[model samples]
Target: MAERIRTLTGHLVRHTGKKSPDVQNVSGNLSPAVQSSFRYTLENPLKTLTKNQRNFYEENGYLVIKYLVPVSALQSYRKRFAEICNGECTVPGLTVMKDVALAKSSPIQGEKAVVKIQDFQYDDALFQYCCLPQIIRYVENFTGPNIMAMHTMLINKPPDLGKKTSRHPVHQDLHYFPFRPADRIVCSWTAMEKVHRQNGCLVVVPGSHQGDLKPHSYPKWEGGVNKMYHGITNFDPTLPMVHLEMDPGDTVFFHPLLIHGSGTNRTDSFRKAISCHYASTDCHFIDIAGTSQENLAEEVIDLAVKRTGLPREDIQFKDIWTLKSRCVKGEQNHLQGY
Candidate 1:
């Protein structure tokens, strides 16, 4: 146990530049169960990931698997997206959000005006992507057998309108999640079309998931930031970053704490991607009352109250998540906190 403590201490010091008081306390109180859950572990005998792939994910916090999704699936999703946007179909509980810049100005009609749709778990066609056997196989490796699709989105990054409102600020996904043992959570993001730097493909800080979740706030960009598009306040600009340029049907599975964002779409077309955040059913909700996430929780609760016409006192951050999440694999367990 002394050797283990030393190793953890060294890692903490190296990443943080000094040993944190919280780490010191945790080291002294470390338990075997807690230590085991400190990071993601590959299943013995392995399910879908090769040893090298598992190692890469452990070291880099993300793995890009080319052609994990098929072209046919991507086409179907695109068709369904257009149908929804064109008002040919309505997806109950799905929130269609327009680009802030376009919404402020003369809004484009039909599908072009919509920038994204969130919580589409109710839409069977789009939800099918979450249940693809290949995706579930990879997701089980990170989240174990029992999985819950905690959040879902089909991001349509519209072309920049002079203002760079299309650019997403660098932030950790965990900042918006109220959950414990973040290692059990992973996000699967697949490109619907060829994505490159010009179209604002994903930009990730390699291995940034090894650090703790930082405080987040809306960036003071001259162009108005999107609602709930919070950014890491202290992200080091000098950190080496990788731009993930992917072809259609390519998917990347990344840790929730990995710091990532995309650039503004400089092309005339929209950059589209489908993503879902999955977590182990064993993971439980966490209270954000005294943490950096409190601000986000409050904002989310307020938005829920306004949208549903529910009393502010009756809405809770966890309740909102519970309503949005659905079991994609295995049996639903702890995440149902209403």
Candidate 2:
């Protein structure tokens, strides 16, 4: 029945020998409510969502909701997605640009994607599904109220020829967005494809989120800020590395700085996912690298101009935005495209 359910749990072949490492002094402890939620992990294997299973999301930055969007919702989104996707006709963001010259120039596997919707700056589904009630309540269960929408994105990795697998490297996401200590920023990835070990799904190092988020070279995702990979690594021989085994409509939520990456898609099908990052309104974007908080926000404006939409209010960064340069020249994006 587990096999029939198709949610296979396995460790990474490369890291198969690696065990979960233990810490002498855990950097942080899980809240009681968060710890208790793990008890309700999905038992049916094919179930949509389980209350107890939500604990992982609280303790860790992410959780996997089996069958998150029903097949009907998924199909409906797909149809609308297709229409929006068609509009791009091979612009920078849309993968379906395959039918166009630039997209045709680069093939995931000789097949070009006709990206209808290009990047999150334009994609709408992210707001519709990424901030789902179930997802919001999941976070509210821990962080309480005053949650605010941070940023949203839709990745149209076209079938056969996509970036997620081959070109995609490992990295921590939160490092891209600076947040205060008390306020946490969370991200959720919803699979529009049958994400499995065979087709290059998300792989994460459990408990790794609690450690130093290693510095990495900025990755060149089609629509996202160039991101870097891990902060540190010390293999333990007990706990196992796991792939975010997921299916269309299944959603996985993780922390801002979780060390994670995916393998290349050597398969024939398309792998589509929607990622949304949320931060509590109470969570302030701070920069602590300065000697004092004085003029810190102003000093970083040139640096953070890339991260527009950030409120003009003063902030004290808790993480180093300079860990990796926000040198992204995302200037030519379709901002005012009609």
Candidate 3:
């Protein structure tokens, strides 16, 4: 059954090996809840964000920071990603190419035709962009001076043809994360090409991050695996959804709890974007039991079992999270680090 599932899904279950070189000592004696309250001092003033930008993000839960990357630099990244996808790059990373069988389903089912290249920052060219000093300062404005890039991805959203993958359901980023202090986590999404409603720009519900963590579930689809992504259950349509239409080099830093998702690409071209989740190393991962987090964790564990051909009972939630979590900057001082 596992072999058949692998044949059907063509999933790439690879692990990341990158670690933050500058190891720093952090207090490990504190409890998870107490550790979340810890804050780091910023090296500079609030120069990264103007008074108005600060007000907007505090009130709306997101900010669209324009010209974070130059178009020339983004174009180089675009070329590099394309080359990696074409097997021109020899560096090892998890690359999920477009699945033809899933794309040809009658009703257009399973995951979308989008290709997701995870942990591409291993490449020096891509690493430079992820650690751009100016951008890191902007991230420091929100997450403090001591920050770590927990997750990064190069997503190529293909055009829509009844493809469910092209259109992501409105969901909270916290659903996939096991860490605490949701306020300290931020995701920077940069457009590699001009993006608008036609090309599936991100749509986020303002002020959604201020609320509590909500339950999440997979949207009903034919032959779909949870895929470690869980969306908010029964998201209210009455809430306003803002379309984040942006040009190449434009980036948006959003809170983890913000309810956001992208629409299907109605145009013919692929919508490319590079994103990374920056988190405070001071925060710890609390044990989530009997909560929506545990529920989603189980969903992810099932997927991992199928992909690794491991028994469900043999896998623990912590093991799965430890595999996914990495420290991109500073040191990993959280529970997983020890």
- Model 1 residue pairs with clashes: none
The CA lDDT of each predicted structure is: 0.81, 0.46, 0.68
lDDT of 1 by residue, 1-338 (tens): 23432332232122222211111111122122323432574463333688788788988999999999999999999999999999998765678888889889954877788889988876778888888877877887788777788899999999999899999999999999998789999999999999999989999999999999999999998979888899999778999999999999999999999999999999999999999999988899888999999999999877776676655666667767776777776557887511
Q: How large an RMSD does model 3 have?
A: 6.7
1 or 3: which has the higher TM-score? Answer: 1
TM-score of each: 0.88, 0.57, 0.79
Per-residue lDDT of 178 in model 3: 82
The whole-model C-alpha lDDT of candidate 1 against the native structure comes to: 0.81
**For model 3, the run of ten residues with the poorest summed lDDT:** 24-33
Q: Give the TM-score ranking, best first.
A: 1, 3, 2
How far does residue 76 in candidate 2 sit from its true spot (Å)? Answer: 3.2
- Clash list (residue pairs), candidate 3: 112-165
Model 1, total clashes:
0
lDDT digits (tens) for residues 1-338 of candidate 2? 22211111111011122211221221122222333324212122222335545555445655776776667656656665665554522221222223222343554322235422323322333335544555555544333333444445555443334334232455666545555442255666778778876666888877666666454443444533212222223433354567888878887767766777766666765666666665544455454453233233344443333343333332223222211111111111211111
lDDT of 3 by residue, 236-338 (tens): 9899889999988899999998899887778877789988888877777777877788887877677667676766776666555444445555546663421
Most accurate candidate by lDDT: 1
Winner by TM-score: 1
Better model by lDDT: candidate 2 vs candidate 3:
3
Better of 1 and 3 by lDDT: 1
Q: Which stretches of candidate 2 lie over 4 Å from their true place?
A: 1-61, 88-104, 107-126, 159-167, 219-240, 288-338
